[model samples]
Target: MTQIEENLFSEFWDKLNGATGKGFGKTVSIDQDIEFYQELKYNNGVFAAFKVHRMQNDMAARLLDENGELKSFKQWLNDVQTIADHQVEQWFRTEYDTAVERAHLAAEWRQFEREAGVLPNLEWIESTSVTPGKDHKIFWGVIRPIMDGFWNRHKPGDRWGCKCGLRATDKKPTPVSDLPAGESDEPAAGLDNNPAADGKLFSDSHPYFTDHYGSKKNILLESDKLMTKYSREEVRKHFQKELKGKSLMLQASQGLAKTISVSHQDIKTITGKPHKYNYMKNTCCYWLPQLLKKAEYMGWSPDMKGTAVPGHGDVKNWHYYRFPLNNEDSFLVVKERMNGEFRIHAIQDKEHFKENKLKNPFEKR
Candidate 1:
């Protein structure tokens, strides 16, 4: 590796180690939280380099091996030098894309806070590139409702290798005809202009912009350790407080509900299910209350009725309630016992729900 590469490797190593609470070379004190973020950024950079450089996964794994001690700077240098010039360019492009997105989101978040309640709409002001294409020109100075389909769907820097950025503006955007004409005849470099064969526009090709733009604020806030550490009950209570008196319909429930409740045991049961999807476990903690809330609104009408739990013999009074949670349907199996106590036999996602369908006593009938 050259001098610059050597320095960069050393810096990354130091930051990574320091973030893990192990100082390198000299003891450099840093706030643990700050170090955590720095460590993530450095790790992302390394992984991006590995991916863009097309380094084999096994080689990357070996470099990170910590059986004995951290690898030396020379060892890292040897590994990095394997990356070719084109790979380095790809790595830079990835980094540039991420940096631009983060900066834009940060600025937008700040402006959102500053202009709260003052600006109901925002416009995307694309940076005037020398060779603006039809795709770029169409989006230039276009005003749209913030958080609506058009704005959410066509945020700047959505396309692969796109360098164009957007500035949020409150003032009405100037008409396209009134805007200055493009200076160059060619389209923007590295941009794909051809629409999808189905006639989907270039903007529609990328969906991340629509899914993530509106959630940027919540995403950043949730990244903090404190926010992530909230217990399931706490999260449920918070949402309940927020949704109180609001007419919210659960897609699965198909009706407006007043309140929802999930016991701590319910959370435990769902999360502790063996062979459950990893996401089902994670989302159960956060989405359980929401699902229950929707369930309450839906009035507990089971799509499929009269199920029985296996191994416990036939029970005719059992009912199943299915609701959507985090893009997947989850089911709550409940049986009313002779003593009048409601017993929850199982709480499962759509996958498990399907697997256990035969166990349902009503399925046979």
Candidate 2:
């Protein structure tokens, strides 16, 4: 696989596994869950695209080289499409099952927390389907603190196809100790007993925990969707033909929409004060340019009908638009000045906007 393919697969795996971890820690957010589902769909699309590229190359080779009686191009195309479809379907099913399992585990953890009033200690429960490994047998009855890094690495269902589970207990956990004269301190050969230099108790290389924690440096950003579909040269040429001088501005705006770089001025304008949820600011930044792009593409003029400014009379030249972001309605209010420049006057959800009765800023009368 190419570097991009490998990175995509790695990201898909991490997001699938990390769902449970985030749930256990109560750090899961709607934004994270939405991104998780989006990444899964994106990865499947990438795989399908790659398959098409490979099929095209293979068809060319078969036509040129004398191999066993070559099939018709039509036949070859159908076979390739069938295989690609199957692969994509299988990928979706596998990932979807894993995501469901992780979500269930997270829900269980939440319920456990609500009833137990503390992180529940886990008791490793070995399955009876297969002969238990020596390490599994040793840890079978052992109870471990939920807060320890060991659970992060060695939680039940850590391995692929693992049928093991953990039973929650409110009692104190059994401490790790030497079994006999020659027994090793570690539970298994590859699993490490010490934390890494980064203060992570789990090894970065551990298969179960490797993808659980780390920055996603290789995952493609959403703004890259347009660039990925069309090359930079192609996009630039198209823009030159259509937008002329504004092409650069469009390109820069689209690029900025993918990142979490919100301006302090925009944040203050939207929230009146610093808001606790940074995700809201980031979401606004991402969608603002997207909304503009959609309007331009659809050739829809901005809606500038002003609403009553609560105590103040109706203000003119204020534009309003609403779009769904993270499964919520994001209402944006902007003002077009005399110079034709647009300024983001305010942004909030539909409910919040209605509740606050916010309006356009004005000079003291």
Q: Give the number of the best model, judged by lDDT.
A: 2
> Candidate 2 — which pairs collide?
none
List residue ranges in candidate 1 displaced over 4 A: 1-77, 80-121, 125-141, 144-154, 159-268, 272-281, 296-319, 326-328, 334-347, 351-365
Question: What does candidate 2's lDDT look like per residue over 1-365, in tens digits?
Answer: 11234343444434444543443444434323333333323333333234333333333444432566677877666656754465346644543444444444545543454545565676667755375445445556667766666554454433333345566787777766532222332333212322211212222343322322122332223213422332223333443455444312222122112222223344344544222222343334433444544321101122344343441123334444554544455555554444454455565555554423333323121
Q: Give the runs in model 2 whose Cα sits over 4 Å from its true position.
A: 1-86, 89-93, 110-116, 128-138, 178-219, 222-365
- What is the TM-score (0 to 1) of candidate 1? 0.38
Global lDDT of model 2: 0.41
User: What is the clash tally of candidate 1?
Assistant: 1
Q: lDDT score of model 1? A: 0.40
**Per-model C-alpha lDDT, please?**
0.40, 0.41
